[model samples]
Target: MAASFQVISKLLGRLSPSISHPLRQYLSCLQRLPVGSRPGLSPFVPPSRSLCKAALPRDEDAAQATEARLCYKDSPWDYLESEDYIEKYGTNPVWESYRRNHKGGIPPQKTRKTCIRGDKICGNPCPVCRDPNIIIHHQNVKLLQQFISPHTGMVLDPTRTGVCMKQQKKLHEAINTAKNHGFLPFQIPFVEFSGADYSNSHDAVGSTPPPQSLTSGETWYKWYSEITPDENEVAKVKKTYKAYLK
Candidate 1:
């Protein structure tokens, strides 16, 4: 519309003075009047490029996300001790309130193989995978303790904890590592010892008799030595290997 107006103005300016003088005066009068009073044109408001730019995530937000991942990766234990942990789960395990999304009242027999498949993540992912801050590490004993049973001291099952199979495997490995490194304690079953346990007098512990095979380089059992291959099979074997048997 602005281009059309400019073209008309130029055409008028090039015409003979008789017609162009009055039109030029009218254009000057329109320019002097407020934009709102203009007949065919509305206000020329600037484009909202700033608002569009603001709608995108800032560099600081990306940096913060990177920093958060690094924090969890480097020292996951710190997140367990941080105020954020307390606020999100005050004195409760990470999986305490988590419920697996399933159909009907009866739950599925097994948890998902993995919460994340490549670049895609399934809805209602397991607690461990859902939170980037909850990193699984052998050194993160405090976090590992949450998945363990207080009474039994055993790692909680995936069915009870609603953890995906992949995360459950990771939890098992981390817990095992923690126990091996003395960060976590494992219960050792106690057995009553008897004096005979250390003794070598029992018949079971006595020296075994030498087998006939070792004594005479013969087959161990009479049946093994007595059996012979069928003549037809022997002939077939010989014929098949005739080229290499020599």
Candidate 2:
């Protein structure tokens, strides 16, 4: 609109006074015409130049073969094995950088139950829950160690770590699995045992009963209530397995 007005003004300024007045009135009438009623213009006209995207045309097959697939599935152990992770994070998790942008006071002990819903991620996701690429595998010892307390040999509280409860649960399960698999050291409280604690008590010194005499029974020492199978259930089981028994 501005460009058209400027061009009309320049035309008026250059024209003879007598012609300018009629030309200006004509231009004003032209402007007042319904927008699409312009003589050479049509609403159906395609914006060809704007619609076309510039590119070097290539074979669709070749493009598909060379196109990179998004694969950021880095396992915990992968973080230690690959130099790329070290380069990007040195020693920090992916969330460390995101966490530094916190607006105010210390983060809450536990973040929301979850930081993700459907396709949207929350504004402040917990460190572990924020990045989808950082997976928790039992073999990822380095990643697991970051959440563990070196001195206490315990996992850090979610509050201190700013982890969401969902991720925190995953973290606990992963850490435990790592410990069980020997990827991480299982920490137990150290207890000083006195000689009296293991002294030769009558029960400790007692000999085991003959295996033949004992047969199948409750426990070796503690006599807990026996779990008697339900008669009706037993009858049902017998009926179900009777064919196989024969």
> Where does candidate 2 clash, by residue pair?
77-140, 109-159
Best by TM-score: 1
Error of 2 at 102 (Å): 7.8
Least lDDT summed over 10 consecutive residues: which range in candidate 1?
A: 39-48
Tens digit per residue, CA lDDT, model 2, 19-101: 89986886677688887775542342777665344332445544643431124353345545566567867777554565523
Q: What's the distance in Å from true for residue 49, model 2?
A: 6.7
RMSD to the hidden true structure, all candidates: 10.9, 13.6
Error of 2 at 137 (Å): 1.4
The regions of model 1 sitting more than 4 angstroms off are 1-62, 195-202, 205-246
Candidate 1 global Cα RMSD:
10.9
TM-score of each: 0.61, 0.50
lDDT of each: 0.86, 0.69
> What is the C-alpha lDDT profile of model 1 across 106-165, one tens digit per residue?
999899999898999998999999989898999998889889999999888899999999
Q: Candidate 1: give the clashing pairs.
A: none
Please state the error at residue 164 of candidate 2 in Å: 1.0
Off by over 4 Å in 2: 1-7, 10-76, 79-84, 93-107, 198-246
Q: Lowest summed-lDDT stretch of 10 residues in model 2?
A: 65-74
